[model samples]
Target: MLEYVKTILQKVSFNAYLFERELKKGMRYLMPTELEEFKDWCYATFGMSHQPILNRYFRPAY
Candidate 1:
C-alpha cells in the first residue's frame, strides 16, 4: 500500500516532504471528488479496498 503511494508520488515528481505534509493536512479526504475517482481507479486496477490504505495515508480534516 505504501509502495503504491510512493510509486504514484514518484511518477508525479512529488517530493516526499511535500507529500507527507499534504497527507497530514488531509488533502485526500478533504477532496471527496478526487478521492472518489481515485478509489474507482484503485478498485479497477488492484481489485482491493482502497479505504484501508487511504485511511492510513490521509486523515480527516476534522
Candidate 2:
C-alpha cells in the first residue's frame, strides 16, 4: 500500500487536483502505521505534511 502511494505521489505533482483526489483515497486505504510513514515521507520530501499543502494548492480556488 505504501509503495502504491509512493508511486502515485511521484506522479501526482503533475496535477494538483489529481494529487488531492489520490491523497484522499490514500487516507482511506492506508493503515495507521502506513499513514504515519506516509506523513514522514511527506515531511522528508516537501518539508511538511502533504495534507494541508495539497488542500491549499489543489482545492477549488475561491
Candidate 3:
C-alpha cells in the first residue's frame, strides 16, 4: 500500500490540481461510494482536504 501511494505521489508531483485530476481519472471504474471513500482515505493519509483539492481541478459533471 505504501509503495502504491509512493508511486502515485511520484507521478502526481505534489501539485494538488494534477493529483486531483489524476485521482478522478484513475477512480472512474470504481463505484461512486467507493470513489468517495477512496477520496476520503487519500485526504486523511495525505493531509489534504478533499473539497479544496477536488474543487481546484474537477469541474462539475465529471
Candidate 4:
C-alpha cells in the first residue's frame, strides 16, 4: 500500500490539488506503523515541491 501510494503521488506530483487529495487518500489506507515511514518518504520526495501539503497532512497532533 505504501509503495502504491508513493507511485500515485509521484504520478500526480504535477498538480498540487491532486497530489494533496491523493496524499490524504493514501494516508487513509496506510497502517499506523507505516505512517512514520510514509511521512519520511513524502518529505524526502516531495518536500521541495509540496512541503506545505505534506506538512499539513503529516503535522503532529497537539
Candidate 5:
C-alpha cells in the first residue's frame, strides 16, 4: 500500500486531483494504523491542504 501511494505520488507530483481520489478509493484496504501513517506521510509530503481533503474521504460522514 505504501508502495502504491509512492507510485501515485511519483507519477503525478500532485498535479492531478486523481491522486487524491485514488487514495480515497484505495483506502478501504488500509488498517487504521496504516491510514494514520498514510495521513501523516501525506501531509508531510504534500502539505496541510491534504488534511481536509483526505480527512473528508477518511471520514466522509463527519
Candidate 6:
C-alpha cells in the first residue's frame, strides 16, 4: 500500500493539486504506524517541491 501510494505521488507530482489530493487519499488508506513512515518519506521525497502542502497536512496537531 505504501509503495502504491509512492507510485501515485510520483505520477502526480507534476500537479500540486493532484499531489495533495493523492496525499490526502493516501493518508486515509495508510495505518497510523505507516503515517509516521509516510510522513518521513513524503518530506524526503517531496519536501522541496511541496513543502507547504506536506507541512499543512503532516504538522503535529495540538
Candidate of highest TM-score: 4
Q: Which digits, one per residue and each the tens of the lDDT, describe model 5 over residues 24-49? A: 66576677778777766766876654
Q: What lDDT tens digits, residue by residue, belong to model 1 across residues 1-62?
A: 43455456435333445544543444343355566555445446433423444456545569
Q: Which residue pairs does candidate 6 place in steric collision?
A: none
Give the per-residue lDDT of model 3 (tens digit) for 1-62. 33454357447846777776666565655565565555556556665444566544334564
Q: Report the poorest 10 consecutive residues by lDDT, candidate 3.
A: 1-10
Question: What TM-score would candidate 5 get against the native?
Answer: 0.60
What clash pairs does model 4 have?
Answer: none
Q: Each model's RMSD to truth, in Å?
A: 8.3, 6.4, 5.3, 1.2, 3.3, 1.3
The better candidate by TM-score, 1 or 6, is 6
TM-score for all models, in order of appearance = 0.32, 0.67, 0.47, 0.94, 0.60, 0.93
Distance (Å) between predicted and true CA of 38, model 3? 0.5
lDDT of 3: 0.57
lDDT of candidate 4 over 1-62, digit per residue (tens): 99999999999999999999999999999999999999999999999999989889988779
Clashes of each: 0, 0, 0, 0, 0, 0
Error of 5 at 16 (Å): 3.9
Q: Model-by-model lDDT, in order?
A: 0.47, 0.68, 0.57, 0.95, 0.66, 0.95
Candidate 1's TM-score reads: 0.32
> Which candidate, 3 or 6, would have the higher TM-score against the true structure?
6
- Candidate 3, which segments miss by more than 4 Å at Cα? 1-10, 49-51, 55-62
The better candidate by TM-score, 1 or 2, is 2
Once fitted onto the true fold, the runs of candidate 5 whose alpha carbons sit more than 4 angstroms away are 48-52, 58-62
